[model samples]
Target: MSIRRRYADCRDGQIHLREAGDPANPTICFFHQTASSGVMFEKVMARLDDRYHCISLDSPGFGQSYQPGEIPDMRFVADRLMEAIDDLGISTFHACGHHTGGCAAVEMPRAYPDRLESLTLIGPVLVNEEEKAEYRKTFVRPFEAEASGEFLMTAWKYLELIGAASSVDLHCREMADHLTARDTMPMAFSAVWNQDVEGAFRSVDIPLHIMCSKDDVLWPLFERAGEMRPDAKQSIVGGSDFQPDRDPEGVAKALGEFIEGLA
Candidate 1:
C-alpha cells in the first residue's frame, strides 16, 4: 500500500505524519529517531500495513513538524504527540519509538496511561544519572552552520558515527533530515539526555517490547534493558542503527509478531 503524508494538529502546532494500511486494523503509532523524520518508517509501514494501520510521526521540531518554542523535555514531546494522535481520533494504539523517540514513548505511559496499549523501544538510551551527566556534556549546545558549507560534512560525519548513514544514498537522505532540523536536533538530543529515561522505562506498566540490532551502538544497553524488564518481549534484528530504513522486513516481522501475539 502507498503511504499518505499528512499533518495532525496539536497544542503546539502541526505534527507531520506518514500513514498506511486500513484504519479498521489495529493502529501502531511510530516515533522516529533524533534528527530524522517519519520517512524513516515508510518501508516498515509499507511492509506491515496489511496487518496493521501504521502512523509514523515526525516529532515536534523534526522533519515537517513545528519547532518547539523552547528546548523541552521528553515528557513535553510525548504529551504533544498524544495530542496529535488524539486529533487523529485514535483513542488507543501501540507506541513504537527509536532512540530519541524511545525516550518520548516511555514517558507516554506516565502522562497518558489509558491511551497506549503497548510500548516498543528500539535502541533506547538507558542511562543512569552519572552516565546521563557525562553524555549531556557531549551536546551542550547546537552546532553553528559554517559559511564554507563545511557544516554539511559535519552532519554527514555525525550520522556515520551513529551508524545511521551507511551508504551514499542513506547518508544523503538522512543528511537532509539533519539539516532540516539542524536548529532543534541538538535540542532534542539535549532533552533526551536531560530526562531520566531509565526511570521512565521502569514506570511503564503495560506490555513492552525492547529491540535492538547487534551492530547498533546501543546493543550494550540491550542486556541492561532486559534485566530491567525481563518479562517484556525482546528481539534482535539485523542492521545498524537505522533498522526500519535498512532492515524493514526484519523490523516488520518482529514488530508484527509481537503486536499480534498481544491480541
Candidate 2:
C-alpha cells in the first residue's frame, strides 16, 4: 500500500499526517505516544493496507507538525484532530492511540461520543493524581542541552529501555525524534500525565479495545481499564510497550478485527 504524506491547518495548529488505503473505506485514524510522531504507526498502517483508510496524525510540535502558540493538552490535541478530519470531509471514523495518543483517543470519544464508531488504545496512560505526581518526578524536566551531551545519551538510554523488543530500527527512529524535538516532548508528556484519564475513559459507551504488551509498564493501566470496562475487548500482544512498531501485524490484525466487527 502506498502511504501519502499530507498536512492541514487546524484551529489549534498545523498537523502533518501519513495516510494510506482507499479513501472510500471507513477511516481508522491513529495517534502516537508522547515525544513520538505518527511514524510510529507506519508499519501498522502498512499492514492494514486497503482494508481500512488509515491515517496517523503528527501531534502539534511532533514530527513535521507545528505547535500551537501556547501549550496544548490532550483534549486540545483531540480537538485539533477533529478539525483536521472535518477539513478532510470525513464525517465519522474509528480511532486508535498508543500511550499519550491513547489519551487523545479517550478524550475524543468523550468530547464527541457520536463521532467515533469504536476505539483501540495501546498501552494507555491512565493514572490517578498521585501516580501522575510520581511520574513527573521520574523525569528530568526541560531536557536542556548539556556540554557533555548527556542529554543525548539520556534519550538513547530511555528509548532503549522502553523499546526492548530488540528492534534497532525502532530505537533509532525514536532516538532521532527525541534528538530533533523542540521541547514539546515535555508538553506532550504533561498532556497525558496530567489528564483526567480515569474520568475520560470511564464514560466511554462506544465499542472499545484495550491492547497492551504483557511486559509494558502501562500493563496495569490496561488491565485496570479492561476491568473498568468489562464490555471492552482486551488483547495481550507479545512485546514491549513499543509493540505497535515491533509487532505491527498483531496490532493491525487486532485493530482490523475490532473495526470490522463494528460494521
Candidate 3:
C-alpha cells in the first residue's frame, strides 16, 4: 500500500493525517489513543489496502497539528475532527477510534449523524469522577513539568506497565507518541475523563463495533459497552493495552469483516 502524509485546514486549525490504500474505495477514518497519533494505524491500514481508503488522523495538540486552545469537552474534539474530514472531500466515512479516540468515535455520530456509516470503538475508555481524581494526581490534570524530569520518565514507565507484554518496538513508539505531545497529554486525558459512555452510545443511530484487548487498561469499560448495547457487535481480541500496536493484524481482520458487512 502507498502511504502519504496529508494536511487539512479545519475551522479550529490545521490537522495532520496519514493516508493509505486507494481513494477510489470506500473511506474509513481512524483516530488513535490520547497522547498517541496516526502512526499506530499503519499496520491496520496496510491490511485493508485493496478494500478501503484508510486514513488515520492526528488529533489536535497531539501530533503535528496545533491544539484548539481549551478543548472543553469531547464534542468540540468531534466537531474539529469532522471539519478536517469534510475538508478532505470525504462526505461520509466509517469511523474508528482507540482509547481516548474512542470517546471521539462515539461523539462523531452525534455531531454529524448523516456523515457516518459506522463506528468502531476499541477499548472505549470512560472514567468516573473517582478514577479521574486518581488520574489527576498522575497528570490527568495539567502536568507541571519538574526540573527533576520525573515527568518525562513517568511516560516511559506508564507505557512499560500498560504494554508489559508488548514488543519492545511497540513500547518505544508509544512512548514517543506521548513524549511528542507532552504538553497536551493532560488535555486529551481531560476530554476522555469527561465523556459520557452510555449517553454517547445511546445516541448513536448507526451500526457500531466495540472491541478491546483482554489486557487493555480500559477493558472493563469495553465490557460495560457490551452490556449497554447487546445488539451491537463486540469482541475480545488478544493483546495488551496497546492492542492496535500489539495486534494490528487481528485488529485489521476484525475491522475488515465489520466494514465489509456494512456494504
Candidate 1: lDDT of 70? Answer: 74
Model 2 ranges with Cα > 4 A deviation: 140-142
Q: Per-residue alpha-carbon lDDT of model 1 for 38-59, expressed as tens digits?
A: 8889889989998889999999
| Cα misplacement distance, residue 101 of candidate 2 (Å) | 0.2
Pairs that clash in candidate 2: none
Where does candidate 3 stray beyond 4 Å? Answer: none
Candidate lDDT values, in order: 0.88, 0.82, 0.82
Give TM per candidate.
0.96, 0.95, 0.94
Reference-based lDDT, residue 194, model 1 = 84
Clashing pairs in 3: none
What TM-score, to 2 decimals, does candidate 2 have?
A: 0.95
Badly placed stretches (over 4 Å) of model 1 are none
Candidate structures ordered by lDDT, highest first: 1, 2, 3
For residues 1-263, write the lDDT of model 3, one tens digit per residue.
Answer: 78899899888789999999888899999998887898888888888978899989998888888776677788877888888998999988999998888888888887776998999999876566787778767657443568998866766777777873267777777767777787777777777776786688888899889999887888887887888788789877866767777788899888889988876
